[model samples]
Target: MRPISTDLDQALALLQAGELVGIPTETVYGLAADASRPDAVAKIFAMKGRPADHPVIVHIAGRQQLADWAQDIPDAAWKLADAFWPGSLTLILRRKPHVPDAVTGGQDTVGLRAPAHPLTHALLERFGGGLAAPSANQFGHVSPTTAGHVYNEFGDALGLILDGGPCTVGVESTIVGLTDAHPTLLRPGGIPAEAIEAVLGVKLIHHEKPTTAKLRVSGLLDSHYAPRTPLLVGPLAALEAEAYQRFEAGQRVALLHHSQMLQAVCGAECHAMPLNAESYARALYATLREHDGDRFDVLLLEQPPQTAAWLAVNDRVKRAASGWLA
Candidate 1:
C-alpha cells in the first residue's frame, strides 16, 4: 500500500493494472477501478463489502465517451449531460454488451457520470475508459468527503488516494433513469431535481423504488449513508429534551442543530450545522464521520425544513437516522 498523493501517473498505472485507487470527485471520494474489467470491479465489491447485486457508477471523462459503455443513447441523456456533465449528475442508460455485469450488478442498465473534479477528469482521459466507482467508504456507511476520509475507510490497503482536497458538493450525484419514456428521479443529490426538470422540459417522476423494473441505483437503500453511532432526527425541542435526559443519566451525547442556538446541557456537545441548504449538504457527511465512534453514545439531529432546496439533505438525514424522537 502507498500513501495518498496527487500523482496522476501512479493512479493511472494502478487503475490500468486492475488495482483500486481512491479518487476524488466534486461530490465525494470514490474507490475507483477500470470499469471495463470485471475482475477489477469485483475488487471494489469485495473491499467495500458491497453486495454483488448492487451496482456502481462508471465515471467517464465526459459525454463523448458515453457510447463506449451504453447503448440506445437517448436525446434526454444528451440534454442532461450537456447541462450537468463535469458536475454532479448521473444518467442511467442501456448498457453495451461489453460492459461488465460486475459493474451493473448483472443488470442490462449501467449508471454513468462525468465527475467535476479536475484530477479525476484528467485521470479518466488518460485511462481512456470508464472507472467503476462508488463512494470510497464501506457499504451502507457515510460517504467520504475528503482524501483523509477515504484513507479512514480503507487505510493503507488501497494502493493510492488522489487527494483533491475536500469535496465541494459533498453528496452523490442526482441519478436520472433515462431508459424509459420519461426520465425518473432515482435519487436526489448534489443536483436538485427541479434543476434537472427545468432542463428536460417535463416533470421528473419521483420513484422511491423502481417497482416495475426493480431498478437499483446507488444510495437508494433504506438504511444507506448511516453512521456507527445511534442517530435520531426530530424537532429541536424534542432533541434538546432527549439530550438533557441523556446528560443527566451520565451518558455522552451530541446534538447537531441547524438553528441559531440550542439549550446547552452539561457534559453534552452541541454542534451548529450550516443553515443554508447547499452548505448543509456539503457539511453533513463529514460532520457525521467526525463525531462518530466512542466520542458519543447517541447523536441528536434537528430535522431541516421539508422543502425542495433541502430535499437531498432531508432524504439523507431520514435514511441515516436510526429512529425519530417525538
Candidate 2:
C-alpha cells in the first residue's frame, strides 16, 4: 500500500465523514474517529477487532475541553493533568452520559487524553468533539509505535495515516481513574506510579487487570499489547535455559535481557538495556517488536527489574507473555 500525507483538514474530513484515520500521539499512533459518532467508533472496533468491552480514549487538544468529556475530576487529577497533559497520560473520569456508550464500551466512565503530538493537536483543535482512538493495530496485538507498524497491520484497509514519526514513549499513556475519591491506576504508561503518588500525597491503588467483567480500554485487557511472536517471561537463567532448549529443537529465538543476563548466548538474537526502570520502560516494546518477525520463533524475555518504576513496564511484559488465548 502506498502512503499518503495527511493534514488537519483532510483528517477532519475523514472523521466528520465517519471514516477512521490514523492520528499521531507522543505515546503511540491512534486510529481516530469522532467519538460521538458511534458508527465511526464501532468501525474502530471492527477494524482493530478490539472487544467492545475495552473502551476507547477520547483525545482532546488541551485541558480546558476535558470538562466536555469527564466529570468530578479530583483535585489530585487536576494536578496530574497540569503536570502531564499535552504529553503521555490518560485520565479516566465519569462520563457526561450523552457521551456515546460505544466510546465507553457501555460503561459509566470514559478515558480521555490531550495528546502532545502537534499533528493530533492540530486535528483535534480544528475538529473538536471527543476523538475515540486506540492504538492502530489489531486488538491484543503489538501497538503501532511507528506508521509502518500501522501500515503493516492494517495495510490498504486503512485510508489515511498521519505519520508524525515514531512515538517517543513507545507505549500507551498511564491511565488513572479519579472519579472515585482516591486516584487509582487503570493502566500504566509514560507516567510513573510514584509521580502520581507524589502529587496526590497518597499512594494510588493499582487495580489488577480486569478479566471477570469486560475491559474498558486497550491496556486494561489482561492479554493485550502483545507481539506476533510468542513471549516467555522468567529470570535470565530460566530464559537462557528455555532459549537453549528451543534452539535445540531448531526454533529461532530472541533474547530480552535486563543487563544481568549473559552478554552472549548462542542461537539467540540478544537485546539488552539498563536495569533502571525509566530507561527500560521506554525501550521495552520497540525492542521486542524489532525482533518480532517471521525469522524468530519465540521471544524469550528476561525478568524485569523488581522496582516500583518498572511496575507498569513489568505488567505489560507479563501480559504480553500471557498470550491472547487466556
Judge candidate 2 at residue 107 and give its lDDT. 89
**lDDT score, candidate 2:** 0.80
Across 242-315, the per-residue lDDT of candidate 1 in tens digits comes to: 88889899889998998877346566798999989999999999999998999999999999989999989988
TM-score, each model? Answer: 0.98, 0.92
- Residue 176's C-alpha lDDT in candidate 2? 82
Worst 10 residues of 1 by lDDT: 259-268
The TM-score measured for candidate 2 stands at 0.92
CA error at residue 165 for candidate 2, angstroms:
1.1
Which candidate has the top score in lDDT? 1
